[model samples]
Target: MIGEARRALPLRTATSRLVVVVRAASAADYEPVLDVLVDAGIRSLELTLTTPGTIERLGSLIERYGADADVGVGTVVDREQLSRTIDAGAHYIVTPITSAELIEQSVTHGVPIIPGGLTPTELFASWSRGASAVKVFPASQVTPGYVKDLRGPFPGIQVVPSGGIDIDGAAEWLEAGAAAVSVGGPLLGDALRGGDLRALRARALRFVTACSQAPRAHRSAVPTRP
Candidate 1:
């Protein structure tokens, strides 16, 4: 499955370092918002499917940024949306919830998929189906300690904490075992509404710096019997 997907969609460069999800009102907002993230050294970005002219904007980003940025579509729910995202040149596809058909489509196209899940069962289910990673949505509802616990059981699973994540919360999530963190409002904040590109850039930098400084906890070694 993975092999087939790669041939069709061609995975973007590793986004495991930093993934930024931006929800904008219009296509005009994408370039500036994306510039902020790219300036902050964030290579991965998700332009929500709900955004106006999503495919058009996706195509523009791919055409302009090329390999300099890893652009994808988020909030994708069905196979139709998935196909359009790929057609628009999205490097990956992200859905807030799992849809096997959508995942299969992404694989068929060769783009990576990140499906959202809140519980252990859901997380495992997504992972078992070949999700490149699982997004832990409404992450604020679950504390960092919860992430630590989940990691204990699924050590290799790539967990990305999504909603309610700020710079500080992003640091906490990474320390707790998140492979990466996605910041939306906190990073974009009023920038979109107010058109404050400077503030947006500053916020993105803060997030990047925080993630860089956050400590990764050492996994506890299992006891060896005598």
Candidate 2:
């Protein structure tokens, strides 16, 4: 089945845009998180495999939302997980680290993959393998300026800062050249532990609006030296 999907479709031809990844903990958590994201106008959502009943929940979400949303699975670590995620109808795959086999599998299955990387070498390696985008995991340790510096040499790399991203910091990352930023705790908040869904939705809307309004950095014109 996986082999057939690979032969039938490919990831490169997938949609071209930054995606929002929601890494929640439980199946119950997904509903509120998704409602918040959807209300905020975010069309893409990713439910990490570790989340309980993720596959079943994803199926339910697909049935409910239909084409109104784009759903995927995240935290994929091995072939088995990859196969399952694909079979669950994930629109894309996201991992916390680079894996050649995973990238190959995603490409074959025709689902875009966003593999995480922390250094220049890892980032380039992931890109070379056809990752839809490279996630700079634990991005708080590295400022947005670092992304700008990276783009200096690797101009077309689509970088998405995953860990430690929040509404306050998302704009800076985007201006620094990140294709998109995946925010978790801030957006989800303590709501996971029984907080208000309305509050979560409101917060999600604010974050999305902020990200949308963030200004892209200006590219400098290079001087030709004689």
Candidate 3:
């Protein structure tokens, strides 16, 4: 199906209402960290392209953890990256900026794409253009109230607040009507640098719990997966 035939969906999973963004210096750092996060109850994983060799190791990562969690590729900026991500079997795609071409390609290939945007126009254009959801990036720059206010003009849009979101901020955003929160540093800590898997698991659980406890808004029904 194409853009006009598909519906925008949110990032949802049975394990948690949070998307754990893993951005390490090396792709080698992904497995152990992912193992800990998955063990700690996080099921939606966004492995960004910024990390070296992410695209190369993606297929293997999915083969290892696909059944346990939704393994997606983020930071997709162009058609080439999007194609490779799909070929690597990414469950979904997330871009740092809204691109009509990328969104169209994603929809054409049947991959859910969450395009990032900060303004109302950007978000709406993405949503109306077939983005699976709109990612409110640099969420640290704006409070949860920004998302709440977006709901006023765009009641049916599904927004996932990403970038600089902390454990508590995850809850706050969710309570403000965000479909889900995409978190990285605050949740990963130093695990990627070989800090401690046990500690990583603890942080993962904390984020999961915080999101679970937040109040959910009555959002337009959308599938959690592609």
Error of 3 at 68 (Å): 0.7
How well is each residue in 30-72 modelled by candidate 1, as lDDT tens digits? 7777777787777778889788887876777888766676787
Q: How many pairs of residues in model 2 come into backbone collision? A: 1
| Shift in Å, residue 16, candidate 3 | 2.4
Q: Candidates sorted by lDDT, descending order?
A: 3, 1, 2
Candidate 1: C-alpha RMSD after superposition: 5.6
Q: Which stretches of candidate 2 lie over 4 Å from their true place?
A: 1-20, 218-226
What is the Å distance of residue 140 in model 1 from its true position? Answer: 1.4
lDDT of 2: 0.72
- The sequence of per-residue lDDT tens digits that candidate 3 reaches over residues 1-226 is 3346443443444236789888889898788889888888888999999999999999999999988889988999988999999999998899999899999888887778889999999998888777777999888889989877887887767788988888778888888888788988998988899797888888888888898889987766543334
Q: lDDT for every model?
A: 0.73, 0.72, 0.83
Q: Residue 209 CA error for candidate 3 (Å)?
A: 1.2
215 Cα displacement, candidate 3 (Å): 1.2
Best model per lDDT: 3
Q: Count the backbone clashes (under 3 Å) in each candidate.
A: 4, 1, 0
Instruction: Mark the 10 consecutive residues where model 2 has the least summed lDDT.
Output: 7-16
